[model samples]
Target: MENTTETTKLLVSDRCDVCGAQAYMRVQLAGGELLFCAHHGNANKAKLEPITLEWHDQSSDLNQA
Candidate 1:
């Protein structure tokens, strides 16, 4: 998939599927959507990217300083 950033902000209620931290990335797969915090997202990117239909990433928001 083409590299693109999603504009919509992720809600605070969106928790990481792996660790329950605030999510900054959303991976849409054929099975369903998975919300992930920056750490887990990067950790799983290689495996997930091949199957992800849409990768809505806002991890950069964490560096807005």
Candidate 2:
């Protein structure tokens, strides 16, 4: 199935997907998945719609950690 929802389109980086706060020195896997903090990621999501490919979701815990 193809994901058309803005929530699913954005690809999670191997870095900090939460809060979009990536550290200079960190650890991440190829697909381990990076998660974002709900408060930050979803807070300004509406404004990011146009430029972002993701809807910004942190409702559920990501498997990265």
Candidate 3:
């Protein structure tokens, strides 16, 4: 069996579930997924990481020119 993973990039249209800012991270929980901006993502990391199944962070893209 071959293991394959599909990666999806966060689009500019994706907004944070909290403040509506541009989303830079995607947090996947068993129930569903949450989109977060850098601020909320960092702030909630401690509380959410434990329950998150997948954390797709693209905050580094902010540093790119």
Best by TM-score: 3
Residue-level lDDT of model 3, residues 1-65, one tens digit each, is: 54332255788999999999999999999999999999999999999999999999989889993
Per-residue lDDT tens digits for candidate 2, residues 9-51, read 3344523444455321121234343344555545545555455
Error of 3 at 25 (Å): 0.3
**lDDT digits (tens) for residues 1-65 of candidate 1:** 75344344688899999999999999989999999999999999999999999888888889983
How do all models score by TM-score? 0.83, 0.33, 0.87
Q: Write down the lDDT that model 2 would get.
A: 0.41
| Candidate 1 vs. true structure, TM-score | 0.83
State the C-alpha lDDT per candidate.
0.89, 0.41, 0.90
Candidate order by lDDT, decreasing, is 3, 1, 2
Alpha carbon deviation, residue 10, candidate 1 (Å): 0.8
- Tell me the spans in candidate 2 whose CA falls farther than 4 Å from its real position: 1-35, 55-58, 62-65
Which of candidates 1 and 2 reaches a greater lDDT? Answer: 1
* Model 3: CA > 4 A from native: 1-6
TM-score-based ranking = 3, 1, 2
Give the best candidate by lDDT.
Answer: 3
